[model samples]
Target: MCVVPTVIGVMSGFFSLLPDLLPMILPSEVQITKASDLEAQRGGKDAPMIRQGAVIGKSDRMCATVLIAKPRCSSAVHHHGEQETIIYAASGKGMRHELSPGDFAFIPPWTEHQEINDTDENVVWILIRSGPEPVVVYLTGWGGDEAKADSID
Candidate 1:
């Protein structure tokens, strides 16, 4: 028998508790990635305003990353094939109504959208996906590239 800690807030139901509690309840392994250990990566856009870092991935059924949207920048329109994405706004600007510290967005799989930061400050958010690997299918090409999303390998 094994015991696992419950995730107090944020998500709810079984899925919320599964990721962190899996190793405890089963014969699986758990891995933790410190904030200082993440490698900086582009936030799927050609602009410098958006940046991202992978928190946990590869060995798990899900992937988590932190996205930083700089002032006056907008990400190219894109979508993840069949992976649902949940975004938790940690800080910074909002698209419509004023978003507080803990506001979140549930993006359905294959939805096309873009993160626009019209404010003068950076907006930081946590992005959690439904799969271990990211499947980015850009609906609109970035940086004037003529390649279509469907043509990508």
Candidate 2:
């Protein structure tokens, strides 16, 4: 006698974990943002005043940008409200609390800090911040007024 095989038993192995496998099996789109597409925005005087091209940009979860500090310049003391930041010295250097090229600093949320460039040449650094958005709150201190004066439009 011919017998009919059961569908449940045959398909159980393939569809039993449909929910768990759907996400992995789906296709995803990748975003590619070009450098020329980014808008040039000015960082606070004490911060690196960016010009020309942007290295990266703020995303829904993180922010990446390049800092271009002129000679004898330094970013004003500021803090990121809830975003932690990773700053890497990409080129040209001065002194960042004794930190130098190939070196990176981890800035915790709400930590006040500054980037100093006392050399005659410009200092370039890549600043990466983690959060839904990068929020900077400048701190007022001894040289706060001076920093404001140095700020560019």
Candidate 3:
């Protein structure tokens, strides 16, 4: 039945049906990402050059992404415009303020902060934002020039 599978977060793929059945049957609001279908990206060897770009997208209400933090590096002080971000530590624990595995943190809309990883390994964080797309406004520092806010990622 759907009870146990739903409770444990198992996406039930239909056994036999028309080729277009899934798209027609499943509600568009529900996004089921299978484990094997998920993609993960990590920082490359020999320290990656600082980069910024928006890849995460939204179906309608929220946008989600998997961010891998480089070792011994921190994100630029930035804000998410009107979007709120929820972060979950997936790997390489001990982020700033000491978030361990399975830990979660919330960032309000337009709140400026950085994700600092002091460890030697890449840190992975699952980010879910309360908006239809990712919006990143980079700044020179906290309360610094908003004009330098480039890349709405």
Write out the backbone clash pairs for model 3.
136-153
Clashes of each: 0, 4, 1
Q: Which residue ranges in model 3 land beyond 4 Å of their true spot?
A: 1-26, 29-55, 147-153
Clashes by residue pair, model 1: none
Q: For each candidate, give its TM-score against the true structure.
A: 0.64, 0.62, 0.64
lDDT of 3 by residue, 113-147 (tens): 88888889878788888766778788878797664
lDDT of each structure? Answer: 0.69, 0.66, 0.69
Q: Which stretches of model 2 miss by more than 4 angstroms?
A: 1-28, 37-48, 51-58, 142-153
Estimate the Cα RMSD of every predicted model relative to the unseen true structure.
Answer: 11.0, 8.3, 11.9
lDDT for model 2 comes to: 0.66
Give the local distance difference test score of model 1. Answer: 0.69
- Looking at candidate 1, the ten consecutive residues that score lowest on lDDT are 1-10
Candidate 1 wrong stretches, greater than 4 Å:
1-26, 39-47, 95-99, 141-153
